[model samples]
Target: MVEITNMCRTTGCAIGDIKLYCAGFTSANLINPLIFRHLPTPNHDYCIVNNGNPLSAGAVLSFHYDNTFMYRDFSVSTVTCIS
Candidate 1:
Protein backbone atom coordinates (compact mmCIF):
# COMPACT_ATOMS: atom_id res chain seq x y z
CA MET A 1 0.00 0.00 0.00
CA VAL A 2 1.29 3.43 -0.89
CA GLU A 3 1.12 5.98 1.90
CA ILE A 4 -1.21 9.00 1.69
CA THR A 5 1.93 11.08 1.89
CA ASN A 6 3.07 9.34 -1.24
CA MET A 7 -0.11 9.42 -3.30
CA CYS A 8 -0.50 12.60 -5.32
CA ARG A 9 2.74 14.09 -4.13
CA THR A 10 2.45 16.90 -6.65
CA THR A 11 -0.17 19.64 -6.65
CA GLY A 12 -2.50 21.33 -9.13
CA CYS A 13 -3.09 18.95 -12.00
CA ALA A 14 -5.19 20.01 -15.00
CA ILE A 15 -8.64 18.44 -15.30
CA GLY A 16 -7.86 15.96 -18.05
CA ASP A 17 -4.26 14.89 -18.00
CA ILE A 18 -2.57 11.60 -17.28
CA LYS A 19 -1.50 12.16 -13.71
CA LEU A 20 1.11 10.02 -12.05
CA TYR A 21 -0.25 9.23 -8.63
CA CYS A 22 0.08 6.96 -5.65
CA ALA A 23 -2.48 5.92 -3.03
CA GLY A 24 -2.61 5.26 0.69
CA PHE A 25 -3.60 1.95 2.31
CA THR A 26 -3.74 -1.58 0.97
CA SER A 27 -7.19 -0.82 -0.43
CA ALA A 28 -5.49 1.25 -3.08
CA ASN A 29 -4.28 -2.06 -4.50
CA LEU A 30 -7.86 -2.45 -5.65
CA ILE A 31 -8.59 1.18 -6.57
CA ASN A 32 -5.50 2.43 -8.40
CA PRO A 33 -5.35 0.38 -11.56
CA LEU A 34 -8.03 2.03 -13.71
CA ILE A 35 -7.58 5.32 -15.56
CA PHE A 36 -9.42 8.39 -14.19
CA ARG A 37 -11.07 11.11 -16.25
CA HIS A 38 -12.58 14.44 -15.16
CA LEU A 39 -15.48 15.90 -17.12
CA PRO A 40 -15.26 19.31 -18.78
CA THR A 41 -17.15 22.20 -17.19
CA PRO A 42 -17.59 25.96 -17.35
CA ASN A 43 -15.88 26.12 -14.00
CA HIS A 44 -13.42 23.32 -13.31
CA ASP A 45 -15.48 22.94 -10.17
CA TYR A 46 -16.00 19.18 -10.17
CA CYS A 47 -15.05 16.06 -11.99
CA ILE A 48 -17.06 12.87 -12.46
CA VAL A 49 -15.22 9.61 -12.22
CA ASN A 50 -16.44 6.83 -14.53
CA ASN A 51 -17.27 3.75 -12.46
CA GLY A 52 -18.12 1.06 -14.94
CA ASN A 53 -15.58 -0.82 -12.85
CA PRO A 54 -16.71 -1.76 -9.37
CA LEU A 55 -14.69 -1.37 -6.16
CA SER A 56 -15.19 -3.03 -2.79
CA ALA A 57 -13.49 -3.94 0.42
CA GLY A 58 -14.73 -6.46 3.01
CA ALA A 59 -16.13 -3.43 4.78
CA VAL A 60 -17.92 -0.51 3.13
CA LEU A 61 -15.87 2.66 2.86
CA SER A 62 -17.33 6.11 3.24
CA PHE A 63 -15.61 9.18 1.83
CA HIS A 64 -16.15 12.65 3.22
CA TYR A 65 -16.94 14.86 0.25
CA ASP A 66 -16.79 18.63 -0.05
CA ASN A 67 -16.83 21.37 -2.68
CA THR A 68 -15.34 24.88 -2.72
CA PHE A 69 -15.41 27.74 -5.21
CA MET A 70 -14.60 30.63 -2.92
CA TYR A 71 -10.85 30.07 -2.93
CA ARG A 72 -8.63 30.12 -5.97
CA ASP A 73 -6.55 27.31 -4.53
CA PHE A 74 -6.75 23.91 -6.26
CA SER A 75 -9.54 21.49 -5.44
CA VAL A 76 -11.06 18.32 -6.78
CA SER A 77 -14.85 18.02 -6.72
CA THR A 78 -15.01 14.22 -6.83
CA VAL A 79 -12.68 11.27 -7.03
CA THR A 80 -13.24 7.62 -7.80
CA CYS A 81 -11.08 5.11 -5.99
CA ILE A 82 -10.66 2.24 -8.42
CA SER A 83 -8.39 -0.58 -9.35
Candidate 2:
Protein backbone atom coordinates (compact mmCIF):
# COMPACT_ATOMS: atom_id res chain seq x y z
CA MET A 1 0.00 0.00 0.00
CA VAL A 2 1.06 3.54 -0.66
CA GLU A 3 1.78 5.88 2.24
CA ILE A 4 0.34 9.32 2.41
CA THR A 5 2.23 12.29 3.77
CA ASN A 6 1.82 16.02 3.99
CA MET A 7 -1.92 16.46 3.81
CA CYS A 8 -4.40 19.29 4.47
CA ARG A 9 -2.55 21.73 2.35
CA THR A 10 -4.28 25.06 2.18
CA THR A 11 -4.18 27.32 -0.84
CA GLY A 12 -5.42 30.88 -1.25
CA CYS A 13 -7.30 30.78 2.05
CA ALA A 14 -8.64 34.15 3.01
CA ILE A 15 -9.31 35.36 6.54
CA GLY A 16 -12.62 34.75 8.30
CA ASP A 17 -13.30 31.58 6.41
CA ILE A 18 -14.10 28.11 7.70
CA LYS A 19 -12.10 25.23 6.24
CA LEU A 20 -12.35 21.48 6.41
CA TYR A 21 -9.38 19.12 6.57
CA CYS A 22 -9.00 15.37 6.33
CA ALA A 23 -6.28 13.29 7.95
CA GLY A 24 -5.28 9.67 7.42
CA PHE A 25 -2.91 7.22 8.96
CA THR A 26 -0.20 5.22 7.23
CA SER A 27 -1.00 1.90 8.90
CA ALA A 28 -4.75 1.97 8.22
CA ASN A 29 -7.17 2.96 5.48
CA LEU A 30 -9.15 5.50 7.44
CA ILE A 31 -9.64 9.21 7.17
CA ASN A 32 -10.74 11.72 9.79
CA PRO A 33 -12.17 15.03 8.73
CA LEU A 34 -11.73 18.10 10.92
CA ILE A 35 -13.18 21.57 10.76
CA PHE A 36 -11.18 24.74 11.28
CA ARG A 37 -12.45 28.25 11.57
CA HIS A 38 -10.28 31.34 11.24
CA LEU A 39 -11.18 34.15 13.55
CA PRO A 40 -9.61 37.42 14.61
CA THR A 41 -7.38 36.48 17.55
CA PRO A 42 -4.33 38.05 19.07
CA ASN A 43 -2.12 34.99 19.09
CA HIS A 44 -2.23 31.20 19.15
CA ASP A 45 -2.28 31.00 22.93
CA TYR A 46 -6.07 30.48 23.23
CA CYS A 47 -8.42 29.37 20.50
CA ILE A 48 -11.70 27.48 20.09
CA VAL A 49 -12.11 24.55 17.78
CA ASN A 50 -15.04 22.47 16.49
CA ASN A 51 -18.57 23.84 16.79
CA GLY A 52 -19.08 26.43 19.50
CA ASN A 53 -20.13 29.99 20.07
CA PRO A 54 -18.13 32.21 17.77
CA LEU A 55 -16.09 34.72 19.66
CA SER A 56 -15.47 38.22 18.48
CA ALA A 57 -12.11 39.78 17.83
CA GLY A 58 -9.90 40.28 20.90
CA ALA A 59 -12.15 37.96 22.86
CA VAL A 60 -10.62 35.12 24.78
CA LEU A 61 -11.21 31.78 23.09
CA SER A 62 -11.94 29.25 25.81
CA PHE A 63 -11.11 25.59 25.35
CA HIS A 64 -14.58 24.15 24.89
CA TYR A 65 -14.56 20.49 23.93
CA ASP A 66 -18.27 19.83 24.01
CA ASN A 67 -18.78 19.38 20.27
CA THR A 68 -15.49 17.98 19.12
CA PHE A 69 -14.08 14.55 18.62
CA MET A 70 -10.32 14.10 18.87
CA TYR A 71 -8.91 10.72 17.99
CA ARG A 72 -5.34 9.79 18.73
CA ASP A 73 -3.31 6.67 19.35
CA PHE A 74 0.36 6.49 20.19
CA SER A 75 2.40 3.78 21.82
CA VAL A 76 5.85 2.26 21.99
CA SER A 77 6.76 -1.40 21.92
CA THR A 78 9.77 -3.61 21.37
CA VAL A 79 9.75 -6.78 19.33
CA THR A 80 12.42 -9.31 18.41
CA CYS A 81 12.41 -12.03 15.79
CA ILE A 82 14.57 -15.12 15.84
CA SER A 83 16.44 -15.95 12.70
Candidate 3:
Protein backbone atom coordinates (compact mmCIF):
# COMPACT_ATOMS: atom_id res chain seq x y z
CA MET A 1 0.00 0.00 0.00
CA VAL A 2 1.26 3.54 -0.82
CA GLU A 3 -0.57 5.05 2.13
CA ILE A 4 -2.56 7.14 -0.29
CA THR A 5 -3.95 9.43 2.39
CA ASN A 6 -3.57 12.45 0.14
CA MET A 7 -2.07 11.37 -3.16
CA CYS A 8 -5.35 10.23 -4.65
CA ARG A 9 -5.79 11.42 -8.17
CA THR A 10 -8.23 9.98 -10.72
CA THR A 11 -6.55 10.69 -13.99
CA GLY A 12 -5.22 8.87 -17.06
CA CYS A 13 -7.05 5.66 -16.24
CA ALA A 14 -10.21 4.91 -18.20
CA ILE A 15 -13.61 4.31 -16.63
CA GLY A 16 -14.04 0.80 -15.15
CA ASP A 17 -10.30 0.51 -15.31
CA ILE A 18 -8.64 0.50 -11.87
CA LYS A 19 -5.17 2.06 -11.62
CA LEU A 20 -4.28 1.21 -8.02
CA TYR A 21 -1.20 -0.90 -7.36
CA CYS A 22 -0.16 -3.39 -4.71
CA ALA A 23 2.79 -3.42 -2.25
CA GLY A 24 5.49 -2.84 -4.85
CA PHE A 25 3.24 -0.59 -6.86
CA THR A 26 3.08 -3.54 -9.18
CA SER A 27 0.99 -3.69 -12.31
CA ALA A 28 -2.63 -2.97 -11.46
CA ASN A 29 -5.16 -5.51 -12.49
CA LEU A 30 -7.54 -3.99 -14.99
CA ILE A 31 -10.97 -4.30 -13.45
CA ASN A 32 -13.96 -3.41 -15.54
CA PRO A 33 -16.61 -2.44 -13.04
CA LEU A 34 -20.16 -2.90 -14.17
CA ILE A 35 -21.07 -0.04 -11.81
CA PHE A 36 -18.81 2.10 -9.67
CA ARG A 37 -18.98 4.96 -7.19
CA HIS A 38 -17.09 6.51 -4.32
CA LEU A 39 -17.67 5.87 -0.64
CA PRO A 40 -19.08 9.34 -0.08
CA THR A 41 -15.61 10.90 0.08
CA PRO A 42 -13.54 11.69 -3.01
CA ASN A 43 -10.40 9.69 -3.86
CA HIS A 44 -8.87 7.43 -6.49
CA ASP A 45 -8.09 4.55 -4.13
CA TYR A 46 -9.98 1.30 -4.71
CA CYS A 47 -10.24 -2.43 -3.96
CA ILE A 48 -11.28 -5.41 -6.08
CA VAL A 49 -11.77 -8.71 -4.29
CA ASN A 50 -13.36 -11.80 -5.75
CA ASN A 51 -13.02 -13.73 -2.52
CA GLY A 52 -15.72 -13.95 0.11
CA ASN A 53 -14.10 -11.55 2.53
CA PRO A 54 -15.76 -8.15 2.30
CA LEU A 55 -13.60 -5.07 1.88
CA SER A 56 -13.16 -3.03 5.05
CA ALA A 57 -13.78 0.42 3.49
CA GLY A 58 -12.11 3.58 2.18
CA ALA A 59 -11.99 2.96 -1.56
CA VAL A 60 -13.93 2.91 -4.81
CA LEU A 61 -14.67 -0.81 -5.11
CA SER A 62 -17.32 -2.42 -7.27
CA PHE A 63 -18.19 -5.98 -6.24
CA HIS A 64 -19.53 -6.67 -9.74
CA TYR A 65 -22.09 -8.99 -8.23
CA ASP A 66 -23.41 -6.41 -5.79
CA ASN A 67 -22.88 -3.72 -8.38
CA THR A 68 -21.89 -1.48 -5.50
CA PHE A 69 -18.89 0.80 -5.27
CA MET A 70 -17.56 1.80 -1.85
CA TYR A 71 -15.05 4.48 -0.88
CA ARG A 72 -13.31 5.44 2.33
CA ASP A 73 -15.43 6.12 5.38
CA PHE A 74 -12.79 8.49 6.80
CA SER A 75 -14.03 8.14 10.34
CA VAL A 76 -13.47 4.43 10.39
CA SER A 77 -11.29 3.59 7.40
CA THR A 78 -8.53 5.12 5.32
CA VAL A 79 -7.69 4.75 1.63
CA THR A 80 -7.22 1.00 1.08
CA CYS A 81 -6.04 0.82 -2.53
CA ILE A 82 -6.45 -2.93 -2.69
CA SER A 83 -8.05 -5.77 -0.85
TM-score of each model, in listed order: 0.23, 0.18, 0.16
Candidate 1 C-alpha error for residue 49, in Å: 3.1
Local accuracy of candidate 2 as per-residue lDDT tens digits, 1-83 = 21212222343321222212223212222322222232234532221232332323333322222213442421112112211
How well is each residue in 1-83 modelled by candidate 1, as lDDT tens digits?
11111143234321222232212112222342333323344543443332223323232222322234222332433334443
List where candidate 3 sits over 4 angstroms from the true fold. Answer: 1-41, 51-83
User: How do these models rank on TM-score, best leading?
Assistant: 1, 2, 3
**Which lDDT values do the candidates have, in the order given?**
0.29, 0.25, 0.30
**Top candidate (TM-score):** 1
lDDT of 1 at 54: 31
In model 2, what is the error at residue 15, expressed in angstroms? 9.3
Instruction: Please identify which of the two predictions, 1 or 2, would achieve the higher TM-score against the true structure.
Output: 1
Pick out the ten consecutive residues of candidate 3 with the lowest summed lDDT: 18-27
Clashes of 3: 4
lDDT of 3 by residue, 1-83 (tens): 12322233454322222323222111234333332222222343433232222233333443322213332332312223432
RMSD (Å) of each candidate, 1 decimal: 15.2, 19.8, 15.0
**Model 2, runs deviating above 4 Å:** 1-52, 62-83
